[model samples]
Target: MLDFTCGRAIAVARNEKLQPELLKVGELASRAGVTVRALHHYDRIGLLKPSARAASGYRLYDRADVARLHQVQALRRFGLPLAEIGVVLDQPDTRFAGIVAEQITALRRQIAQASALRGQLVQLQRQLQLGAEPDLANWLSTLELMGAYDSYFTKEELQRLPFFQFDSQRDGIWGRLVARIAALMAGGVPAASRQARHLALHWMRRLERDTAANPDFAIRMGALMEGEPSARQRIGITPELKQYVIDALAENRLRIYANYLDADELRRMREHGGKHGKQWMTLIAAVHQQMHAGAAPGDPAVQALTREWFALFRQGAGDNPATLAKMRLAIDSEPALLAGSWINAEMLAFIRQSAATLQAPR
Candidate 1:
């Protein structure tokens, strides 16, 4: 009986040893394109276990273990969350197609949100280039404003908007120039003075660079700015600052043009430029176009723009200074004279600078 029992035990041992060789956990992960940590997690959760253990006691797996890993990865790729994946792993035949469809839907939503975020960054980059120096706090807060735009535009659409179209370097320069103007204004600077007009002239050159003489975008952006007071405020666009800029630009324009006119002609211009101001508005738009197109100071296109502007001024002044000088005096004395105009200081400043070469010798 003892011999028979021992013989039976030896047979059992031989059968166990003859079983196919298994792979170590590291080897299995390498072959499967998965991490060893993942294998351990699966083992701990009783998900995929090694088929055996080597004599050295390391975990070992067989071909069946590899098949299980593939299933897990497939389900994951289909967008199955880990928790739900556990349940579906047991019955993949019923869940595979359904899970993949669900995952695709979720991925689309995530892509949309990411796209919106990307649009905001592009817009912000443009703003920064345009001369926005947002603080760290307001910088992030500005991104929150993206939600407001989502209702009206997609990321690609946002990039095409006027607010995002300025040349980035010039836009940045605009911010610094605005600071200088604001400082001068705050210190009681007088726009009629040569010093202030020079500052205004500096500002105009940058404005021309930013707008590239394109007013449509500038107009669109201005409307948005007026509509979004909070955004404007954060960027330092105060009414006082705006008014100061306007005053400075007008004064600078007058000074630069004064070089080309006599006292009588200047007097006539002031009257007509204000009286047929609607025509002046047309000239203003034309000037923007010239600036946007980067016409030379003496470009014929620019000459045509000035001719139109001069004609409007000549209309009211009777082709001479006449009552225009008094009109100027009145306009200068009252801030209210500037209140209802669409013209901005930045625009005037730009024209003043660009028209510099047209000035007659002193």
Candidate 2:
């Protein structure tokens, strides 16, 4: 009877060992791309357990253990805490596809946020290169503001915007411009001042120069100015700046025709006061002249002008001078207009108005 009982025990042990043949612990770990030590640790923590041990004392896992390891690895890849991973793996009816889908969604969101952060960092880097003192706190605050309007902007739009940077001399000139503009707005100076108009002309020319060099100018400028409505409001530029820019743009169109129009062609074209034609033509001409001259858009004059305009747009409110300078550099490197075409008047007008509104006096 004792011999018969022993024979039965041996048979039972052999059957148990054979049952786990599909997944040895090492093979399971290897399949899951994890270390064997990791599998052991999971077993020690009760997160996963092998079904049996062989005669050689090697751990043997079944299909269920292999599945559990897959889930744990997937969750870890998604940045879940190990504790949470354990809880998820322990659930009796956890749907693998559902869990994977949820993780994928989470990863997508994280990737988008990281992309935005990288964009913001690039702006900061540009500012630093231009010798601007960028404020981390303000940058963070700006990012928060941007998040509020995330839906209003596409990823492409957000990526194209510029940040402000500071330069002492340029900042000083910008301060003066802002003060002058604010005083005018307060005292009701006409938007079409000889000085103000000249300022506007200077701004347009400078912008043309900068954008000619930096094709990304419009996008970066949009990003810097549009993210904070409160910043615009603080500068007292609620409505007038938009109208002011509109008028200035009209004036610029006139100036372009006056300076560049062919005499007989001008008469044939009914160019009364050289107004109401394409606005971007003037910008194109300006850019063309600069290219012909082989001038760098980030020239000191351009930087000073950008600083002044940024300050003026803020209506004496502070901005990141360095960021603006960097943006100017970028603009100088790539012209907004393509080789055979300039930006459309409507688009230019819209961008100009929007930028003005964003930078309106506070």
Residue 120's lDDT within candidate 2 is 67
Candidate 1 residue spans exceeding 4 A from truth: 1-141, 144-172, 271-362
List model 1 lDDT by residue over 32-139, tens digit each. Answer: 788999999988887787777756567877557776676677678767776676777776476556655766766765675676567658877887898976467565
What's the lDDT for residue 72 in model 2?
A: 82
Measured on C-alpha atoms, candidate 2 has an lDDT of 0.51
TM-scores for all predictions? 0.41, 0.32
Which predicted model would earn the best TM-score? 1
